[model samples]
Target: MNKISYIRWFNEIGIDDVPLVGGKNASLGEMYQNLTAEGVRVPNGFAVTAEAYCSVLEYNNAWQSLHAALDGLDPDNIRDLQARGEKARAIVYGCQLPDDLQVEILQGYAQLKREYGETISLAVRSSATAEDSPEASFAGQNDTYLNIASDDALLDGYKRCLASNFTDRSIHYKYDNHFDYYKVYISVVVMKMVRSDIGASGVMFSLDTETGFKDVVFINAAHGLGENVVQGTIDPDSFYAHKPSFVMGYRAVLKRRLGSKEKKMIFTNTLNTGNIAVEYTKNIDTSSEERSHYCITDSDVMVLTDYAIKVENHYSNKAGSYKPMDMEWAKDGLDGQLYMVQARPETVSSQKKGNILEIYHLKERSVVLLRGRAVGTKIGAGKARIINDVKHLKDFQPGEVLVADTTTPDWEPVMKIAAAIVTSRGGRTCHAAIVSRELGIPAIVGTENTNEVIKNGQAITISCAEGETGTVYDGLLGFEIQQTDLSQLGHPKTKIMMNLGNPDQAFSFASLPLDGIGLARMEFIINPTPRESPRFSHGEESGKLVLT
Candidate 1:
C-alpha cells in the first residue's frame, strides 16, 4: 500500500504514463498538470492503472482463462467473435480485486469524497493503452459509466470498464490494427462528473474534421450528456470558428447549424443494467422550444475556441508537431462554466497525406438524392442497402452501401466491407464518420431522411470530393478521379496565393502548390447563410486561411 503503484492522480501522471493509465487519462493528466492556470477547466480526478486490472485478474486466477477465451478470435466470424468476447468479459468481470488494490481504490475514492463531499457522482471511462493514435483511434470501443454515485458503484464500474476491453469493436480494432491482444491493456478513469445533464455536453475537434483543415475548430453540442452526441444518437448543433482570425481578434464565428435535436440524454437516479443496479443516464424527447434553440451561446463558442486552440497548441508543441486535438467538453449548469473533460489527438485529418490530391468528378450528373456532412474525399458507388436494424445487416454485401440512422461500434463488421456508408444522423466525428475514415471509405452523415427516400438495393453514387456537401446521386453515376501529385508538379514562377471559404476545398487546396492563403473569411460570404448544414456553395473575395 505504501508503494502506491495501483493508482495515479491526474497531476501525478503525464502523457508518458499512457502505458499505465492509458491515453485518455494520460491526456487528462497532461492537461491538468499543464493547462488549468491557462483557463482550461479540467475537472480533477484519479485513474486506476492497468497494472491494477492485470493484478486483480491474475490474483483471482482468471487471467489465463480470459486469454484462452479470446485466443485466436476470428474478427470476421461475427457469431464466434460475440461468443468469445462475452466469455472473455465474463471471465474478467468475475475476478475480484486483491485486498491491497481494493484498499487503495477505496482510499482514492475517499480523497474525491473529501473534496467533493460523500455523494459526488463520478464519470467512469475506459482508456485503452493503445487508443487515440493517428493510425488507430478506438472510438467508443468500450463502456462509460456516468453518474456513478458511490464507492461500490465505482468498483463495479471499474471492473466493467476493464471487461469492455474485450468488446466486439475492441477485439476487431485490435485485430485490424495488428495489435497484440494480450499486451493491450485498459485503464479506468474516474473523474468528477460534470452536471451537463442540467447544462450541455459535446465533442469538438481542433481542426475541420471533414477537410483536415487545421485552421478551424469544429464542434457538435447537445442539451445533455456527451454520450448522445458521441454515440451519434442525436444530431447536435454544429459550430465553426476560424482559429487564425479568431486569435487575431476578428469576428471569428464562421457558421452555426441548428440540428433537430429531438432527444436529450439526462442522468437518472439508478437503473438495472442486466441485473446490476447502477446509476444510469437516459435519453428523452426534447421540447419544441429546446429543439429550436442552440445549446451554447455564440459567446460561449468563442470561449471554447480559445480553450481548444490553447489545448491543441500545447499538445502540438509537446509532440514537436501540429497535433490537432479531439476534445470533450461540458458546461456545469450549477456554475454556468464550461469545463474540458477529455482531449486526444485529432486522428483522421491530421494523419492524412496532404501531398496528393484525389478529386471525384461525376461525369454524368443525376438527380441529387440527398446531401450531408461528407466524410473523406473518396467516392463510392454501390447498391443502397437500408439497414434499419443491425440484425438485418447479415444480408449486407461487400460492395453495397450501408444506409442507417446511426452506426455503433457493433456495426464495424458490416462497415469494413461496405463500398460507402450513408447515415441519416451524426456528424463528421460520429461513429460512422470515424470508422469510415479508418476503413478508407466515403460516408455521408446527418442527411435527415436518407432511410425514407433511398430504396433498398437501389444503385447509388456517393461523392464527397466536390466539397463538404456530399451528394448521393440516384443511380450509379460515372466519375473521374483526378489524381494530382504535388510532389511531381513544379512550382509556378509567381507565388499563387489562393482565396478560400468553403471548408471542404481546404484539404484539396493544401495539395496544390500555393504561395499562401490570402484570406480565411470568418463570415457567411461564400456559403449561403447556413441554417442547418455547414456544407454550402462558395461566394466572392472572402478569403483568409492560415495553414502555414
Candidate 2:
C-alpha cells in the first residue's frame, strides 16, 4: 500500500478509498469486495490512482502552466475558457506516463487478461474525484472509451480519460460549483468490457426518479450500448416494478412503455486503406420488431428488479438508512448473464423529505394543447420561445416557456432563465427533466413535436399538477395552489419542513405552523447583494461578528 504505487485492484478498495480511486471506481470496488458473494456480478477492473494522475502532471511540469492558464479566467467568456481548457488538456494529453506508472498499468491490464482472456476488450472510463457525490453528480461530464482491445488503445484511452477533466462542460461545472481545478484529480478505471453492444444495456434507479416514490424501481433499456439511453439519443423501453408487491411474492411489474428505439450503437472494427485497424462505435438502424418490442423479457425485468432491491438493501444496511441507488446494467448476449456496470448514490429524491404533498388544481378545465411526461407538480404560464439551437438561446426572455428538441449540460445557462420547458425528446432522467426538477420548474418532456407545435411569442400554460401527464395549453390558464397541511392534525411523528429559496417569501411562510426550514438556499440571498469585504467595528475583532 505504498502511496507512490499508483494502481489498485477493485478488490483492494472500497467506498472509503474515494480520495484514492475517485467515487465511481471506489463504489465499484465497494461492490466488488462486499457484494460479489451475494451473487451480484460486477466486471473486474483496476483503477489508476489519483496519485498516478498527479505524477503525470508533476513529471511534465504541468501544474504551474495549468494554474496560470486558469487563474483569473472568466467562465462567462466562452471562447477564452475553451481556449484555456483545450491548452491545459493538450499539455496533459501530450505528456507521457511516468515509467513506473506505465508499468503498473500494463501489469494491471495483464492481470485482467489472465483472469478474463488475452484479447479481452476493455472499457476505460474517467472517474473524477468529485464525481457521483450526493451533493453533485458529474456522471456525464467526463468521458468513457469502450471496446478497447489492444495495449496501445488502452494506453491511449487512459490518456484521453485524464484529458477529459478539461472538457468544456467539466470545466464549467467545476467553476460553477466552486471546486478547485488544481485539487480535483482524475482517476482512470479500466474494466472488462461487458459486450453489451451485442445485447441490451440501460440504466436503473432503485426509486422512481420523477415522483420521488421509493416504492418502485425504474429502468430504461435499449439495444446495444447503454450510451444511447444515457445520452437520450434514442427513446428506450421503460419499466417499473413495485417493491412492495415484489417483496410480497406478487412480482408485480406496475407499468411498461415501449419507446421508438430507432437506432442502436455497436462497436465495429474497420480497416483503413493502409491496413491499419481501428475500433469505434457505429450507429445502425434498429429493425421494426426491435423498435416495437421491449428489449428485455418480463423475466429479465424481474431479475433486474430483484438485483436493484438487493443493491439497495446492501447499501442501506451499510449506511444504517434507506439508500436509493442509481445503477447501470447490461445483459451479455453470449452468456445471457446480467452485469452491473456502475452504481452511485441516487442524487435526487433520496435527499427530499416525503412527509408533505403540495397539490395544484385548475378550477376551470381548459383545452389541453399538448401532453407529455410531467417533471414537476406545478403550473406556470409564459410566452413560448422555440429554440432549436443554443445560439438562439440569447433571444429567450425570462418568464418564457422554452421549446426545444432536446438539451445537454451546455444548455443549462439558458435553461435556468426559462420559466418552463417543453422538449420533443428525452425521458425523466434526461438533462431537461433533471435540470428542470432541480430548478423547481414545470416541464413536459417527450412531447414529440413541441417545438413545431408551439409558436414563438405565443402565450402558453404549462400544467404538471396532474398525475404523470403534463399538459401545455394554448392560452394563459388560472390555477389554484392547495396545501394539505399534515402538521395541523395531532402531533406529527415526522418533522414537516419547507424549502425556502427567496428571502421575500420567508417572512410569509414563517407564520405557518411547521418545523423550521429544511433548506435555505444561500445563493438567492447573496447573489443579489453587492460584493464587499468583511468589515468589523472597533470593539469587535476581524474574526468576530457583531449583529445590529
* lDDT values for all models: 0.85, 0.81
Counting clashing residue pairs in each candidate, in order, gives 7, 0
Model 2 steric clash pairs: none
lDDT of 2 by residue, 192-230 (tens): 999889899999999877656677898989999988777
Residue-wise lDDT of candidate 1 within 225-326, one digit each (tens)? 888788777788999998999999986988898887878889887657665564487889999999999999988899899999999999888899889889
- The candidate maximizing TM-score is 1
- The list of candidate 2 runs beyond 4 A from truth reads 1-3, 270-279, 363-367, 390-399, 485-548
Model 1 residue pairs with clashes: 519-543, 519-544, 519-545, 520-543, 520-544, 520-545, 526-539
Worst ten in a row by lDDT for model 2: 502-511
